[model samples]
Target: MNAQAVRNYSNEFLNIGVDAAALGMSRSVVATTNDVNAVYWNPAGLVNIEDYQGSIMYASYFAGIANYNYAAFAMPIDKQSALGVSLIRFGVDDILNTTELIDSQGNIDFNRVSLFSAADYALTVSYAKNLIFKDLYFGVNAKVVRRTIGKFANSWGFGFDAGIQYERDDWKFGLMVRDITTTFNIWNIDEDAFATIQGAIPGQNQELPETTEITKPKVQFGMARKFDIGRTFHLLTEVDLNLRFARTNDIISTGLGSIDPAIGFQLDYENFVFLRAGVGNFQKTTEFDGSKSLSVQPNFGVGFTYKGIQVDYALTNIGSIGNALFSNIFSVKIDYSFFRR
Candidate 1:
């Protein structure tokens, strides 16, 4: 499997949430700099900013996937305690639908005409504090989701995220687990939909047709180190391991064990701007072909923070195609934060 082939999504909801148009395309992962999304990318990063700051992020991705939006606020509750809140939203525009069905005349008749869309949002609250030797941050997220199609409800589910971050003199380490105890039950599921599925003969009541939400285990563990190579210049290196466990009907994509590792290096100049370029095995480093190849192997990014504003951009490959995944393969991200006493 190509490094880029390493993929995981807890809920099917993510299928519609992952967009190519969004920034951070370099790795098909969320972009984090100075925004509330840091709460998701890595809650420990939330403490890197000022004591009291508020931020917002907006990412438009996948020509039609969605508009990913995030907002957050962090405050110092006391000398050793800090609290924060963040929100994330993803969804699509309305869609037109017209399914063909046989009418009473044994001819095709499409009577149901409707428009619908699917979207999901999650809210998180985080906290960080210093331990006996260094900084230790613990955070949790609560999410409520709803999915619908036309006049019928598709499914709805709830999930949570917990993470811990630790920092020392020259390194930073963090761990996170997401999507714990999640389920989906759609609204108004017509019994006819399951009349025949998976080669099962029609049955009068094997069980109520309920929404089946996708569930998976996701974990992220990583370390980042800083080095002083020259005067007024710094080098930052980061390596992370991600594992995903999930059961899916999609055979090729289903399984419970897959390991993904990512590494990146950035050169900082004058404590203001950074020139970054690194290659990581996103999914798999090689492919089924007989030769070694990099699928989504290159990550090039540039970021700078001046005053109260910060912006970053990165480029990657959705695949080796010159179409939408090529030219639009680049992602640009902008974040704004306000500091208050």
Candidate 2:
């Protein structure tokens, strides 16, 4: 096959998001993220970490056929700067390899069958600093991505991201640019392993696949505000607009780009018990009658914190909106300072 650069759905695993809190909010926390998960959302929010923080999350997708995991750690460099590291992995394991199932004598050989996994991994290093301007913060991320498909092919990619956050009183705003300089992935295919499959099909799989992939830039703008309810309850609401430079099924689509809007709300009692809900992923779907209808995904979550240890749970795609299956996500966070006391 001719070598070509793929422009769509490259490195899509990164888009799955990290942390239960953020996913529960449909990733509307760009303006209010202030924990280890910020390493993936808006690194600029890492500056809000008071001390060393660590977080981990786990989720299963497609009815347990795939697994996703995330981990992150952040610490303050000083009073005005912070640094963080994060890793994400998404994979489907124990896939049966059938390429070698046929013996040279034209006999079926079940003994030769093997199992492998196809997985994608990403590592991000983030830095956030408080700017000279009051309530303004800046952050950047350096990312490395790796992908593997059993022993047949593998790829390596690199990218950069930049984000900024600004606050005025109870209102906050944020902007995040992913793949600011465009990300590129180069793949290497093993000819030996590929040869087995090349002959398995008459005309299909006769040539090598594309060797390059390009991920274009994407931007997200966010706004958030906090409201006080009496003296014991607080509500935080956020809205985010995700922009992609291609037409899609998003609610707002045009020739130049598409805009997908998301909104989230979080309520807390004395910052200890939390309840969250979000709506996002608006799309126009075609009905059986050739009519288009709007669909939205709704998510819900709950959390509890004690002694700086927080646990969160989220139910995503609650009603199976669109073609996505519902998933249950869980996450835990720990503050080192809590152990010091």
Of candidate 2, the 10-residue stretch with the lowest lDDT total is: 316-325
Clash count of each predicted structure: 10, 0
- TM match of model 1 to true structure: 0.69
Model 2 lDDT per residue over 166-269, tens place: 99999999999999998999899998998878866658857688888889899999999999999999999999999998888889999999999999999999
C-alpha local distance difference test of each model: 0.52, 0.91
What is the C-alpha lDDT profile of model 1 across 1-341, one tens digit per residue? 11111224535433221212222323223212223445556555555555556555555556546566666677656665556776666667676544324443657555644456666666567665555655776656666665554443465666676667776778777776666444333345545543322113434455544445445557767777779977889977777665667443221234555556666677778767766765544432344565543344565667676775555655543333224342222222233333331
RMSD of 2: 1.6
Where is model 1 more than 4 Å wrong at Cα? 1-8, 12-35, 100-113, 180-214, 246-256, 284-294, 317-341
Q: What lDDT is obtained when candidate 1 is compared to the true structure?
A: 0.52
